[model samples]
Target: MLRLQSALGIFALLLLAFALAENRRAVSLRQAAIGLVATFATAILLMKVPVVARAFGAINDAVGAISAASRAGSSFVFGYVGGGALPFDLKVPGADFILAFQALPIVLVMSVLTTLLFYWRVLPPIVRGMAWLLERTLGVGGAVGLSTAANIFLGMVEAPLFVRPYLSQMSRSELFLVMTGGMAGIAGTVLVLYATLLAPLIPDAAAHFVIASVLGAPAAILVSLIMVPETSVRRTGGTLEDPEMEVASTMDAIVKGTGAGIELLINIVAMLLVLVALVYLVNAMLGLLPNVGGAAISLQRLLGLVMAPVCWLMGLPWDQAVTAGSLMGTKTVLNELIAYVDFSKLPADALDPRSRLIMLYAMCGFANFASLGIMIGGLGVMAPERREEINALGLKSIVSGTLTTCLMGAVVGVLS
Candidate 1:
């Protein structure tokens, strides 16, 4: 039954993309088949193969160590508020500061560490290798391949810097692929923070997130290709122009990375504050509406109603589908951060282990409405000539990205 649902989910996503294609006649079945099979095979290797699983295990241990190191720094600076022992003991019965001081600081530490590693020419090789593999396996242009691979570690705006020279020359389909890749994958800077938030529920949360980002890259390209097939000829797998790299030293890299991380931290905190308050305000307004079964219905309930069908198609039973659907809606409407916060707070009995796992993967992406604006602002600045095009394709890319993440969830469900 789970396998059947997974198959149906895949078919539904493919058909939906085809139905929404700007050039339906241009949609290539051969290309779609290759992409779908590649994505499925990648998922299997990451999740099912024992050798690959062990590799991921080793990587997870490293991430765990990073988390510990970040905590050590956080404890030193913020003291007990950062999940450490209180400097001076006092009986204050309250929860530790998890979000502001603990989980969020990991982003800052990772940003510095990642920047230092990039300065040492560590990440470029990995990004280029993945991009090269994608180019060979999926027959995509280098610009799209490189941007997609870089999105695994960097922000949507920052990743495009790797292929900035080619952005103006890319076809509509290639630009769309780039957009979808950024939307579909989470940055490494925040991966550990999310893992920290979700670790209680999912013991191997860092590994799960790593797998999602890896699987999402190819899936993003597949959906983009189907939605907007390239009509014009473009170069495939060529040398990337080295942007004038400038970092005075490792210290400079760390300083700049930490500054960038502070900006991200501020954005995250403010965004969540405004969004959460908006949700509250909307729910309060909704409270005045007539109740069903003598219970007040809010935005989440409405969103749940709309999204429940999608959850059902993804193999969630009806009894659990509504709650899972709410999380999906929250993810798409708000950002994944808020949705994850809500998910972690869900009662233990609200969802079974399988349903919870499926929803976790399904809701793991940056395909919300806010991200569309960010992409336009960030990517637009790089190539002002393409701003209009970016705006035009924003909605389509979001749809493609959302479908990609959910499809990933379905595939994992089948294998599980």
Candidate 2:
């Protein structure tokens, strides 16, 4: 029964993907057929292939190492003299810090590592190689294609830097593609953090996070193409650009990267602190309202009501659907980091195994409201002439990107 349900879920996801594409172009039976085949191929590569699996393993190891180091640092700072020990004894006091487990340190280390790999010309080729394959099969442009591929490792904002020279020249469809790609995949830095947060809740979460990143790449491309089909525009042949020599010496890159990481760490910690407090304040306000069903109407519950149907469509069981939907709502309205924190706090039996896995994949993107503003501001700076277009498309891109990741989750759920 599960197998049958899974197969049906995959079919539904493909149909939905094509339906989204049809909004932009006439749904050619031929194109739909091709897209379905390509979608399955992507899923297979991400989930089934041995080499790809091995690569994900390598990435997971790197993330795990960084997470361990961060936890060690957190322990040193909080568990040591200045930091007070917890009333309830735990092995690592820093592990109690919500942000610490999210692998902030891993992100810092990966940023420097990725920079070093780029400088050595090792990573771009692999990115370009994947881009070439995608272009050959999916018929996307070089700049958009490369940007989408690079998004697997870099953040949406950072990926644009790889093709920084082309933003001003890209057409509406290409611009949408880039934005969608950014929204779909997360920065490598955050992946480790999420892994650590989820590890305790979901077994093998680090491995799952790595798979989500890779799987998200093609899904982003597909959904973006659907949202804005390639109309009449100059078709640029896809080619991988040579990585620029290190901006500074290797040591300089490390120092700068680490400095940048420190800033990110500080920003994340501050944001989490403020957001968590804000949520509490909001909940308190809601508590002032008259009780409904013997409890005050809270924001999270309201979001859950709005999102339950969407979760159901993703094939989550009814019992767990509301919980999953609420998390998605939190992610969309607030931010993923906050949503993950909320998810971590849920009671042990609140969600079943399948639902938990599905939610992990669904929440794995930068599709929140905050990201919308960031995209507009960031891209506007890069291509001021297209600022209006970026702003107009911002909301649509978020919906499309969030839906794309959710669709990937559905596909995975089916396969599982």
Candidate 3:
């Protein structure tokens, strides 16, 4: 019965994309079919096949080791606040951890490691290989495919830089795909941070987040194509470029990586501080309103009211749909970090196992209002010539990206 709902959720999401398609007649059913199949296949392979499942499980271990290493650096600098022994005993759950000191620092470690890996020629081949698969399966050109594939590991803003030279040359559909992929996926630099925050709550949280991004790729591409079908026949070049090669030495990599990580960390901290407060402010404003159904009309409740059906279609039971939708709403309006923090604070029994897993995947994206602006500004800078066109597609990309991740959650529900 849950599987049936999951199946319907997938079609409903695709139908939403079709309804918003710039050229509905140009939508490629063959491409969409392949994407749907790829999303499910990727999930099954990563979670079901013994050998591959073990690999993802190893990823869980790897993330733990890496998180400890990050704590080493952070703990040295920040002392107890960064994850060292606490002076006071905690009675409540999740009170000891500090987001700024502990989890956000993981970005610095990841950035440095990522730079060294890229410098050592590790990530390029993997990205190229993935892009190759995307090109073959998703029917996107190499440059666009490479950029979209890179979003699995890189942030939305950073992924387009992989195909920086080709931005202006890419067709509108291809550009939309690039943006949609960025919105649909999260960065590896922050993946550990999220996993660390979620570790105590979800088993193999790291592995699940990794799979979320992996599965999200095809879903993003599928929805992108559906929303903005490729109407042009422009040829896209295959060359992939990276600033990593420009690094002078190991020290250079560390310095540059640390600098990049610091910027990301600062940005994340700032956004969290401001956005969480803004949500509070908004709820405060809403507090003046009269109660409805014995509950105040807070932002979460209102959002939950609107999103409950959507979450229900993704296989969360109706009884739990409001709770799940509230989280999804928090993710959409406040950003996934805040949503995750809120999710982590929920009582364990608030959501059943299936609902918890489904919500995790569904909320895994940069589909908030903030990201929409970021996408517009970032792409506008990269390809000034296409700024107007990009502006036109920004809202569509968010919708597409949101649907993409929800579709992935639906797939997870069906398979589970």
Candidate 4:
């Protein structure tokens, strides 16, 4: 029965992809069929390939190192905050300081490493290889294909750099595909941070984070192609331009990348501080309202009500469906970081292992209100003529992207 349910979920996802392509003149049934098969095949590679699995293990080790470093720094500042010499001990009850301050350093280091990899031309080949496959299988233009592939590792703004020259010339459907891809996957820097964040709760979280990244890649491609098929004049046979390393020499690259990573680290810490405080404020305000069933009707609760059905569809047990639903809603309406924070705060035994794993895969992306601003600013700056198009597609991209990740989560649940 579970296998049948899993098959049904995969079929529904493919049908959704096909529907998105239906509007395009170039997207024949044959093309859509090929694209769907390719996506499934890629999903299998991400899950089963030994090389890919080992790469994820490396990422996990990096995350663990960062976590250890952060803990060392935290110990220096707040001695015994977690009832030990460590800055924040995971074994200590109610010790969220590690998450609040320490986890971001991993993002910083990963960002610098990512820049260095790009400088050496190591990353582009992998991105271009994925783009080539997407292009050949889906019949997408090169620019769109590369941008979507690049998005798996880089942010929405950064991915566009791969196809910067063609931004102004890209058709509306292509632009939408780019936007949808951005919303679907997360930056590599943040992936490490999230791995550390959930390590305490979810076993093998590092591997899961890596799998989520790869799985989200094709999921983004399929969803974007579905929402807006390639219908306009297609540019043919253009190769992907290499990403800029933004440095003059190897030493320069290292220094500059490190500096940029510091800035990113600071921004992440500040954002978390502000967003967490804002949630508290909102909850306090809601607490003033009359209580229902001895609990105040807060935003999280409201979100849970709205998203519970979706969570159940993803195969969460009944006891945990609402909690998982609330997290999903928070991720969509607020941000993934906040949702993960909430997930971390849940009581032990609140969710079984399976549901927890499912939510981790589901929430690993950049789909949120902030990303709209990012899309508008990043794409708008690149192609001023398409500013309106960027704005119009922002909300839909978020919707489609969130739906795509959820679809993947449903599939993962069935597999499990």
List the lowest-lDDT window of 10 residues for candidate 1.
Answer: 236-245
Off by over 4 Å in 4: 12-29, 56-132, 236-300
Residue-by-residue lDDT tens digits, candidate 4, 1-416: 64455456666655655564546555556655565566667667776675887776675565456446656655556555521354433684335445434444444444456567667776667655755665666767666777776666666766665565467767777788788888888776466667777999998787777777767766776677666776766652246566454567778767876676565455545544665567668878999999987888777678778777666667776678888888887887677877887888899888888778878877888877656655665566557798898888877887778777877787677767
True-structure Cα RMSD, model 3:
4.5
Query: TM-scores, in order shown?
Result: 0.75, 0.72, 0.76, 0.71
Model 4 Cα shift for residue 392 (angstroms)? 0.4
Q: Give me candidate 3's TM-score against the actual structure.
A: 0.76
Ranking by TM-score: 3, 1, 2, 4
Model 3 C-alpha lDDT per residue in residues 219-316, reported as the tens digit of each score? 88888999999988845633445333568899998898788767666665664566557767888999899988897788767776888898998998
Which model is ahead, 3 or 4, in terms of lDDT? 3
What's the ranking of the predictions by lDDT, best on top? 3, 1, 2, 4
In terms of lDDT, the best-performing candidate is 3
Which candidate should be chosen as best, given TM-score against the real structure? Answer: 3
How far off is residue 384 in model 4, in Å? 2.3
TM-score of 1: 0.75
> Which residue segments of model 1 deviate by more than 4 Å?
50-132, 235-300
